[model samples]
Structures are given as C-alpha cells and as structure tokens.
Target: MVTGALAAAGFAAGALLPPRPAFASEQLTIISWGGGYQDVQLRKSFFEPFTKATGIKITEDQWNGEVSKVRAMVQTNTVNWDVLDVGVGIGELCSHGLVETLNWNRLGLDRTKFLGDDKTLDCGVPHHASSTVIAYDRTKLKNGPKTIADFFDLQKFPGKRAMQKGPTSNLEWALVADGVLIKDVYKVLATPAGVDRAFKKLDTIKKDVIWWTAGTQPAQLLGNGQVVMSTAWSGSINNAVKESGLPLEIMWDAQMLSLDFWVIPKGARHLDEAYKFLAFGGSPKPQADMTRYGNNGPANKDAMALVDPTIGPNLTTSPAHMANSLEFDYSFWGDKRDELNQRFTAWVVQQ
Candidate 1:
C-alpha cells in the first residue's frame, strides 16, 4: 500500500531499456560521499528498505563531493549514477542543465515543510541537515562556552581549539565573535574591511587552533583530549558520542546549518527510479529513522515528532538547537567559492 502510494507520488517504474544498457532493469546506481556518514546511514536507513519495497538491486558508490566528476559523466554520454548527494553547486548545475529539475507536485513533496524556502534549494531533495557547531568535552569544561564570541575568547574559555581549515563557516564565525550580528555576517563579509576584520579575529587564535580538513578529526580530537572544544560536524560528533560515549556537547549558537540534497545527474540511467528513491529517502519515517543512529536532522518538518526525544535535542534541525542557527548562504558560496577558497588557502599556509 505504501509503495503504491509512492508510485502515485511519482515513483512509477520506468520503461525497461535494452538488455545491455549501463544498468540492467533490476539495478540502480547511487553516488554519495561514502564513509560512515553517508555509506552506513544510507545503506541501512535508505537503500535496504528501498530494495525490499521495490525489489530493485541497488549498487552504491562514493565520491569526494566533486561536481566536476558528475559533469564529466553527464557530458561524456556515460552517466551511470541515478542519484547524487550534493552540498553546493545545485543551482549552478541546474541552470547549466547538468542535473534534472525537480517536480514537487509529482513527487508529493511539500515545499512549505522543508527547512528553507524553495529558492534556497535549487530543485534538490534534501534528505537531512547538518551544521558546523562548537563541540566541547563536557568532562573537561563543565561550564562551556555558549556563543561564537566565547569560542574565540581565549581567556574566558582557555583550551585547545580545532577549526576546519576552510573559511566557509570559519569566516562567518569570526565576524560573529567579533560583534557582528549573525544576520549581518555575510553583509559584513562582503566588504573589504569586513574581510580584514574577520582575518584579524582569526589571527587572535591562530596559534591556538588545530586545523582539520576531515570531518572525523574534530570528534577524535575532542575524545582524545587533544582539544577541549572543536568546530565539528554535528552528525560526526553525535555518531562518535553514540558509539563511544564521548563526553561531547555541541553549542548551536551561530551554527552554519547546511542541507545535503539528492540530485539526479542530467540524462541519468534511471530517472523514474532515481526520483522514487529520493522521495522515499526523505519521507517522514525514513528521515526520522536516520536520526536514531546518527545526528543528522531530518529535512521533513513533520518527521521531528517521530524522532526519539532523547536524540532530538542533538539534531541540527531540532527545535531547541535550530532556533539559534543560520542556513548557510548557498548563493554566496556559489558566487564566491573559488575566490574565497584560494584566498583562504593562501592565508592558511602563510599563517
């Protein structure tokens, strides 16, 4: 009955292509950022059930969040992926016709229920939301810092700190800590003086910060007592704590919340099945089930009531934690990604 309902919601099976196509009629291919976060979560919470319900064999693969590969596969007439897990570039790719456009009406997806408005999403189906927040070891700092300013203030909360090497969230956090309002972070970051101010604020703790490029590093550092607090991915910290019982707590103040969406590459092998997978993956129950094992906040607003309350408070989209967070500006990153990436890299090496 549920599968029948999803079919009505646009999950109708596609016409079986030739016997020797890129994927057989029974096989569906999916690409995502593998490892525990994407691999384990999707396999258990999404793929296994999807396969059970539809009897389609699913083959999962991983990528390093490189849209270039997706573009190449599509342009070369060798597109194999049915669905893609993407962070940024959804809009640009959609405009360039590199990814398929979404039909909310057909998918039975409620636009009003997703976290951000439709304009912010660029036609991708968001599975869950995660944020880069301050994660502290409660055992070490009983009275941990509450705001971005506290995270920056060396004297008030003195301890080793870890920050992602990139400047996306760091730049915004720096300005907010230096007295810029959370709402004005991007506005100030737009100005030359504001850029200087953010860099200078970062310089204050340059010596104190342990730069990390991988998502797992911050959680590991916190558990190993290498840093008292770290700017960590909310999901990664939650998983670490659940697996090992780490005394970690996340501070959601000024958090830069980001949504990971499922997109279909242009001319994907299985368009109907891809759409079906995305819609199924984001429905209330599946979204809620993901939170039971990991800290990812469900994209469906109606799904919150289904999540265990014990785990709800730790999710990035949880009401208690989400009120103080900011939706990351996807447009800003789309426009300035390269320029800022270069500047940030140079600044990091020079420091």
Candidate 2:
C-alpha cells in the first residue's frame, strides 16, 4: 500500500510539471493543501515574479494528507514535492529529520527580517501567524468572555462554547485553564503529569463544549448563533463579523498565537528552485500583499510596516495584538504530540 501511494504521488507530481530541459531551467512542484485567497496572492506576488526572474516553472498540487505524502516520498526516495506549506506543529515534526535544513545565507535570506525572531528558524521559514481567539455573538451574549480562561469558565460566561478538537491549540488552552502560567505552558506540558493535568481540566468542560474539527466550522457556528462563545481562527472570525454583520468581537487577551511555515522535503528534486521560491516568498512585498488580500498576517516583520493601519491592528503579528496574546510553543507539542493526542482522544471519548 505504501509503495503504491509513493508511486502515485511521484506520478502526480511529475504530471503537474511543465516539461523543461534537464539541468537547464528547473521545474518545481509545490504541494499545498488548497488554493484559498492566499494562493491567489502567492501567484500574483511571488510565483509569477519568481518564474520571470529564475526561469523556473512552478506547478502546484493540492494534497491534503501532507505528512503521509512526505513520508512516502522520503521512504521511496522519489520526492516529488520541492516546496510545501504546512502548519507549525507539522513543520516542527518535519524539522526533527523529515525535511531539509534551509541554507538561509546562501539564499540571501535574513531571518531577522521575519516577524518572530530566529527562534522560529529551523528546516523551514515561518509563513504566516494567526490567533485562536474567543469570538462571541454580541447579539447573544451582550457581555462576552474577555479571555481564554473566561471562555472555559462556563459558570461565569454561560453558553454553549465551541473549541477545536485537535491538540494543536487545545493543550495550551487547557494548561491555562489548569492554572499553569502562559509563559510556563510548555515547561509544564513537557512532563507526563502536566499532559495528564491538561486533559483532566479539559474533562471538566467536556460536557458543555462543542468540538470543532476544522477552523471554518466554529466560525460558522458563531455566525449562525449555534455557539455563543467559541475559540475560532482570527481570520475566520473576521470573515464572520463581515459576512454576518453580527456584532461579534474577538477577545485578544490570552489568545493562542499559531504560525505556519514553508518547507522543503529532504531529497526534493528541485533544491535551487525551491530555495529561490522560499526566499522570495519570505520577502516584505509578497508577504504584505498576502496579508492584505487574505487578512492573514505575514511572518515578515517588515511586511507589517507596509500593511494598512486599519487592518494592521487586528493582525496576530501586530505589536498591539501580540501584547496580550501568547506565542504557542510548537517545539514542546511537536515532541510529545502522539502521547498528548492519544490521551486527549481517550478523554474526549470517555466524556
């Protein structure tokens, strides 16, 4: 089964490329989950300019099960994907050994230019940052939850609240609920006992909360009044506020900040082209353009300067916004994710 999957991925990757002479101009394949507004901006701001500059033809393939595909490619040594965009958690896991270490200096890329410091540096470059925030329908709850802790405190902020079912943002929220300081979140989660305590706290509200698997779902529920207080993606919440015309407000305090990255798998076929794309993708202009179009903040700090002040204040990377929010520790979760997931899943089922 694994061999067949790898062969199929290789064929798919090859089939998407525009034929080019070997060792002349490289053909790079970018395996992304889907082309949302971000994809449109990438094409106009990054890909087109990159192709014109480097003479490299870039092709994109939509693959949802990214980790599986990357693993298959690595095992078969038939790596079809030269560039990939993945969540921060998965990016950290890949950095452990699954992906190639980026040569930033050789690519003329400076890490200091990005939003988060060199702490986010590794096998990939940070793409965009967003927050998991409490969004409440002003119509339903005149006084909504002001923080993540309030979102969990059903007694004070009584409502049918929605939260992500996955471990990505939940564990951090759980730790906060259990009275672990935000700065010491991962430090506590690093221990097996800390992981247990997080789940135990989650069990307390398991009956009152609705679990959402995807980012879009909770926002939809919020718009429809299916949920009054919920943890939602900042971008999705902004969309709901605009589309529904509801008096929905995001509580930025203690909001869990998350980031995504652009990565290259080990043994990729087009290393030079991929590096070119990464460096260009991380630049100020392209990053700013993407944020303007998608309402998602860029990882390039310089890009924030170019962003419109009206939209800038709401972005996760904004200085004002980042003040009250907490940066999620991807490294800690990446190391102990399997165990955390197993325990969280069992606890959810028991609830």
Candidate 3:
C-alpha cells in the first residue's frame, strides 16, 4: 500500500518498475562517503527502507568521492558499483560519460520537483542539500564569530581555526571574507585576480589554520577545543550537537550549500535494481526523512513541506538560513578544479 502510494506521487520509480523474481537473491551495490552522515541520514532513511520495500538486498560500500575509481571501473569494464553518491564531480562525470544518463520518465521523478538547475545536472538525481558553514563552540566563546570574514580575522578571534584541506569552500569563503558578495562569489572566482584575492585573504590566516580532511574532524576539533572555529559540513555538526550535546553553533552567513547526488556507473550490472532504488530514494517522504536524522535538506520540492517543523528552520535551504548563503558552483569548479586544486596545494605548503 505504501509503495503504491509512492508511485501515485509520481516520484516512486521503483514501484512502477517491473517486479523481479522473489527468489532471485540479487543484491545491489551502493557506494558513498561513509561516516555518521551515511549511517544515519542515508542508511536509515533510504537503504533500509528501500531494501524492505523492494525485497532486493543491498550491499553497501564506502568511497572518498574518487571519480577516478569510477572512471577506471567503467573503462576497464569492471563496473561493480551500481549506484554512487557523488559530490562536486558530477559535471566531469556526465561530460565524460562515466555515469549513465538518467531517464526521468523511467524513474518517475518530476524534474520540477527536484532542486538545482536541470541544465546543471544531467546524469544523476540530487537527494539532499548540505552546507559547509563556519561553526564555533558557543560554550567556549561567549561572543562567537558570526560571518565568514570573522573566521579569517585572527586578531578579533585570536586562535587556531580549522578548514577543510581543499580549495572548494575555503576559496569561496576567502573571497566572501575579502568583501565579495555572496551572489558574485563564482563570478569573482572565475578570474585570475579573484583567485589571487581569495588566496591572499587565506594568507592572512595561513599560519594559524589547521587543515582537516575528514568530515568528522571539524566537530571533533570544536568539541575538544583544538580550534575555536572551523568550516564544517552542517550535518556533521548537527549530529555532533545532537548526539554528544556539544554547544556548537553554526554561522549561517555565507554558508556554502552543496548537493549530493545519486548516480549510476556507466555500466552497472544491476541497472534495473539501481533505477528502482534511485526512484524510490527520490521520493518526497524518504528525502524528508533524511533530515529527521540530520540537518541536510531534501532535494524534492515537496519534501521540505514534509520535514518536521522543528527541523525545517535548521536546514540549509530554510529561508532564514539561506538569506546569506552561497550555492557552491559545481560547473565552475568542474572547469577549474584541477588548476585551482594544484594552486591551493602549492600555496598550503608555502610559508
């Protein structure tokens, strides 16, 4: 009955798909960035429910968002991963045909219902929107920094700070901190001068910055008082606060919002099962249920309405939170990632 209801809603492609033999015992392999976020937000919300609903077993795996591994699998004709949860590299993946071109009709998803520009996403369906925001331990600092610029101001908030060890959000935050408006972030980043400006601003806090590679590091750093401020994924911080009772608070100003997508490897062996799960995962209720475990916003337009009112205001897409946010430009990064990543790496090693 529930599955039928999902199909009626026009996004439940799994229920609409032809049924598989009950005894076939086929299992779908899914790979994602594993941590508390995947364990709770995705596993609880989609994986377990998807398995129960479809009766198709799922074997989950973890990846660090390596596009090259996906490329190698497709190129070598050893595509083992059926569904992938990818971030930041969808453009290159689609352009290179590393992933399958989605059939919205087959999936039964309404393009209008999903967030993000259709032109920007062609190979995958966005499941949730998460943000990287500057977070501080409120218990430690009575008057915490409130803006992206404050994160870079060592004099005012004199202490070591944490930032992801990458060019993506760090570059954008630096640009915003240096006085670029939120909407013009990508525009300013498109030129050499703008890139230099971001790096120059980063230079201001270079010595005092502690770079983090793991998603859990920021919240952990804040909890341990290793750093007073850090740019962290919203879900990670929220999970920390909820589970550990940390007094962490996020600075929503200039939060960098990014979407995580469900993509199929170009030649997934379990194509049918992948599509079934993809469609089921895109449904509004599952997307909204994701937020019950963490703060990531659902991608389905209607899912926002379904989200618990208590959780809605804390989401990255919330009107109050979005008033000063910046959407991460995957397209721009698609073109400049390699170039800027190398530059960022070289800069990080310098004095």
Candidate 4:
C-alpha cells in the first residue's frame, strides 16, 4: 500500500503505437510501484496499448518492495503476479532462483546499451530508468544547489531539508558531499570505516533533515514549503511540478541513475501470456511513451529518438546531465543490504 500512495503522477500513451487489435486475451495482474506511477504512467504507455494490441487485460497490483513477500509467494507456489516491475533486489532474487530466467532474444531486446553495459540480468528485462537527485524550489533558493556537496553546505545553502527515510541514496549523497568521488561511492561504502564516515557526514545535518518515506512526500514537502530542498525520485518531483505548478528545479549533479525491471516469478500462473507482456512493454515505442508521459528515462537507448526533444533536458540520461551522473551499484546493495540496513536502522533510532 506504500507503493500505491507514493506514486502520485501522470500518464499518457504514445501516438507511435501501432493500431490495437479488436480482441483481448486473458487477464494478468502485474505487480509494481503503484499509485499514479503505475496506474497512470504504465497503464497508458504500455498496459492499455498492450491490451489493445494483444487483447491481454492487464490488471495491476501494488507491492511494498519486500523480497520476503515475493519469496513467500514463490515458495508456497501461490504466485499471482504475471509480471513484476521491481527495483534493486532483482539481482539478489535472481541469484536465489526466486525469479524466472529471462530470454533476451525472446523478449525482443538486444544487449541494452541503454544502461551503458546493458545491466541486463538473466532474470529480468530492464525497463525504465530513474535517479535520486536534489530538487529545490527555484522561488525559495534563487541560486540553488547544483551538486551533492551543495546539499551538505548548509552555511551557503541554508534551509530545512527533506530526505528519503532510508540509507540507500542518502549514504551515497553523504559520501559525495564529504568529497568522495561519484565513482568511489560504493567502493568506500563496502568498508566499515566508509559507512561510519558516511554516517558521520550525515550527522552534520541530521537535526535539519525531515525524513520522508513515501516517494510523494518529498515533492509534497517541498511544494508545501515544509522544506526548501529534498532528495526525490526524478519522476515524482517532475510530475508534481507539472501537476501542481510547484516552482521546483532538479539539480542533476552526481545523480545516481538506476533502472527497474520486469520479471516473471518462477510460478507465474500466466507464464506464456506474461512473457508476451514483458516483450511488449520492453519494445522501443512504449519505452519512449513512458519517458514522454513520466519522469523516467527509457531503458532502450533507441527510445530517445522517438521521444519529443522538449523533455530531453529533464531526463536523467540526457547528454547534458549524464556526464556528471553515476549508475547505482546494485550488486553492492545486493551483497550488503542486510548488514548495512542494520547499521542504518540503529542510527535512525538514536536521535
């Protein structure tokens, strides 16, 4: 239900999609980060068009991004979701054989140059891309933050701040603000002292931080003047600005780019139909549609050509912004999530 409320955004499909079919197939319940991000964005860009094209009635459900919930369904052989649009844990689940094996060729995808090295795992089709970046009210901070270090420089950029209530991107930003190179974030985080150092940096502004859990909260917090700046998902803040006329601007410096994937759980009831949907969604046109309608970048690099040039400036992978960005180290999180989360949890409760 958290995913449901967190995603308050918009949706629309592309005119580029081919004509829809007169008929539809059996229904499938796809799980994803819900609310408008799923209900509006994917439904318009991919699902509705997919149903029209192949006659597959796609129903969507929200999941809390917990691997254990997915594991429970897999182990009990009660997998209801046909396709899962999941985040960072795909690598860990794939390693444990919890997700179905992906067939790159069958999915109508090549080695995706979209993600630099095509971070395509064997168990998932990489879909849309997003990033954790600093967003500030241009009206509030006339000359705003342009880098992660600016986020920590309270003296120069003084304002109450809103940050996600988790250590994932926060730790990375902490280190970067402490003068760690973008490329060296995860490497430094892998060590005990590295983590301590990140937390120590965070302590500098701990009292000033307004912790947010839902994705929508950061945007809402900023729009309502609860905080002048926040680290927010690209899609969430952009959608809020477009919808509510919030005078927000995203600072792309050292943005951590990440991609979500569509995966079939091992015991999916609509196995074959699900695979068809997976392939359909990954096609270039729909990926472009998603970018056009939402804040995410396309997982397929070729999609850039199809998307209107107007939105290019806001994209995470745009030529202008990509230079200063760093791709998130999913493997680092996959290997160290438990250990790191424990420390992060204890730190949060202390003050």
29-62 in candidate 3: lDDT tens per residue?
8999897767877899999998777767777899
What tens digits encode model 1's per-residue C-alpha lDDT throughout 1-351?
A: 874654443323322323322223655788888877666787888888877666566778888777788789888989988888887666556656788878887777787788754655556888888888999999989999989899999999887899999888999999989999878888998887998899999999988999998888998998899988999888788778888888899888988888888888889888888878878876888888888777788988999999998978778887878777777877677667788889888988885
TM-score (C-alpha, index-matched) for candidate 4: 0.87
Clashes of each: 0, 0, 0, 2
Worst lDDT 10-window in candidate 1: 14-23
lDDT of 2 by residue, 1-351 (tens): 985765566556545556532232356888666656437766776677776665566778876644766787798999888988777545444545778877789668788776553444766787788778878877778877766778778789766889888776787788887788888987887887887787777777788888898878976788788777888888887876777766778888777777777888889888888888888888887777777665578887878888878888777787777886678776666666777778777777773
For candidate 1, give the lDDT. 0.81
Best by lDDT: 3
Instruction: For each candidate in the order shown, give its overall lDDT on alpha carbons.
Output: 0.81, 0.75, 0.86, 0.81
- Compute the lDDT of residue 160 as modeled in candidate 2: 80
Worst 10 residues of 2 by lDDT: 16-25
Query: Is candidate 1 or 3 superior in TM-score?
Result: 3
TM-score of 1: 0.87
lDDT of 4 by residue, 144-181 (tens): 98788989988987879998888899999899999888
Better of 2 and 4 by lDDT: 4
